[model samples]
Target: MLKTALFGLAAATQAIALATIQAKGSKLFTSDGNQFYIKGIAYQLTEDDPLAQGDQCKLDATLMKTLGANSIRVYHVDPTADHDACMSAFSDAGIYAWIDVDTFSTYILPDNPEWNETMYDAYASVIDAFHNYDNVAGFYVGNEVLTTGASSIAAPYVKAAARDMKAYRDSKGYRSIPVGYSAADIADLRPNLQNYLACGSNSSESLDFFALNAYEWCGQSDFETSGYTFLQQNASDYNIPIYFSETGCNTPKPRTFDDQAAILGSDMADSWSGAIIYEWIQEANDYGLISYGPSAAATATNAVGGYTRSGTPTPISPDFDNLSNHWKTLTPSGVSMSAYNPSASAPSCPAFTSGNWLVSGNVPLPTLGDAFKASGSSSGSSSGTSSGTVSASPSSSRAGTGGSSASAAPSSTGEAAAATSSAAAMRNGVPVIAQWAVWLGGR
Candidate 1:
């Protein structure tokens, strides 16, 4: 314990007094005083996808660099995914990484240190493996770790783990990297964050800044994720800065890329320091602005940075229309990460037009744990500002509209393709508008 405490002390000194938090309304400052603006995509690092693994990686990275993309949110890694190749591509391309915590569906209890230990060991191993990379922004601890609202116990493990991980990184004398889990928004993560921070009287001490995956799906209204406005208003209590680990949105509403953007674009403008879209290739369903060449649904060969208007969106040979029209609502400059005050209390959102989205029979209120699984996903939090989010991870990804569901993500080759195909087919599986997917061509 003395060793752990000492280690913690040393680690704290390294990052303390440095004060760089990316909360709503605050500039996104890194531990190194670096101010960042994210413009990228959430793509797989699998060998099958030319954008990530093999020779295609060169093509993929080149396209991103050409287009203006500065980062790639790496998720779902396979054994043959070419880890070094992917990271190298991002690094050489000058792209940041919205790295995830391996797979998802984590709900380890604090008392279950054995379980916690096992998971943390693996989690730490990944962090250790990548922390040294300059391009890496930080670690995204869990993907909807509390989706089910089913964990009878609110584990303070995350807070404890954050401290332990920091110590582990520092004992060996390493620079501090931002670290935290990714929830769609604070409402989904409230349980975990609150419990994690409540570990001791000095709760905030355990974790670094918080991270959010603020992807607003279609049928959504003018709203930021639920707690962002609250956080902005109460920035003093939740002083921890927030890095948008992921913020994606589908476009064109029902068809291809609709010229109309979400009404919440203002919320994004005024509420974040860093955020990235989830795609680049203009594929079917208005997800990617360009296609990966082999998409069975789209074949419209659009130039790197093609359309900038609302007219017939150059289709990307997509298979389904499971997307929301978000790109249509940019602040004109596109990809705005500057901070602003929360809206004058957000009004009721479209998703929540109906009372409570979650079907009480399936998912009870005051969601306990399992941050990634919502049976009948709901929208809006009656507490003034409206914010509702859905979680997607390698283990299980959920869709928010009416019928939210979860499925284990594939980790191997054949299986991964199936997941990808299924995701493309289901259309509903579209990730929240990840604001970081724009495929960049130039600096």
Candidate 2:
């Protein structure tokens, strides 16, 4: 017993020594101040409770290390769980976490997002849950909340939430945890949303970085053809960091994952940071790079808009090996962190023009509501509910809209052919269409 305690103590000490990451200008830096790039994967164990699954995380972390991953992004976290064990497990394994603070249903509905005290309380609770972990890289205020042109109204509220989170962190005297947003890759509105988020100069109103769930690069594509060139040109003068919050195209089976090269390569390194793959475990969506456990599940079903597995020991897909090989050869930029101009002012907000999707050049940000002032805690008091067990159902990779039954995404593979197809047909299974389908359904 004494020997076990000693070993645990040593492990804790080592975990505590991991470097904390911070954002300076458009780049990330380690505590020792080396430039950091994200080589990550989306990890959501919806079937298991994250709070009670430290062992599972250890199991996951071991494989992540083998894949040469440096980070992991988890979309929904149960704010009530004690994340120290799992967080420590990742830290010890040299993996960082970029977590989202909101939930799939109640917290911040995209169509009618409210930056109220209740939302603030929830955000604060999430911060308290992971703030102590050295490897907690950053927090995403919202994910694809502002995916479509209609959802543009949610922008101000998203910024408000980010502002409040920053203020909350300062009030509690915590490290400057980067707060940002993850947008959907809506071709028409993509540039406008990124510009708007990075326009405000007030630290409270501005985003630390911007991310887009881009899947434009399909099978055998190049930068210009994939629309990355246009993306770089549009965001050329933005003040905050930008990256692919979620990427990895799924239309072509046995995905070669060629985008990994351009994303982490020298050509686009100036304009983008590293990207996180869409997912780690296979689900009904058919996006996962591996199965849940060590061995292949015997009966994997592809119903319910995603693939479901039934059996012990999940299997790793060929995509994993394809991606791992790419990761092994890919070299992240070693740009000096000191080269960034921290005192630089932000670009002016894009003006609201007729026919364009941008809102007023200077939209007023929401203030922290009074409801939270009377009932919340930024003075280091515990905030989120501490449910010691897994309470919610497993979430689908494709999140449903808040209140509506929507259209389907584009369902075919041939791009030009699909584009010319009926809008209804286009809405069947295409990711872009899927995004709109979800929004349309909720409406």
lDDT of 1 by residue, 1-443 (tens): 00011344364211112222232223344434445555556554231232234455666676566556666766533323325555666567766665654432232321111123334555566666565455666565544444433321222334445556666667767556666655534354343343343223342334555655554332343334423455344332343444455444443243332212322244443334445554544422234545544333223332222322112223343312222223322433322244333332211111211221211111111211112222233521111110222223221121111111132111111112111001101124432321111111121
CA lDDT scores, all candidates in order: 0.38, 0.63
For candidate 2, the lDDT comes to 0.63
* Highest lDDT model number: 2
Q: Model 1, residue 304: what's the lDDT? A: 20
On a 0 to 1 TM-score scale, where does candidate 1 land against the true structure? 0.53
RMSD (Å) of each candidate, 1 decimal: 15.3, 11.6
Worst 10 residues of 2 by lDDT: 413-422
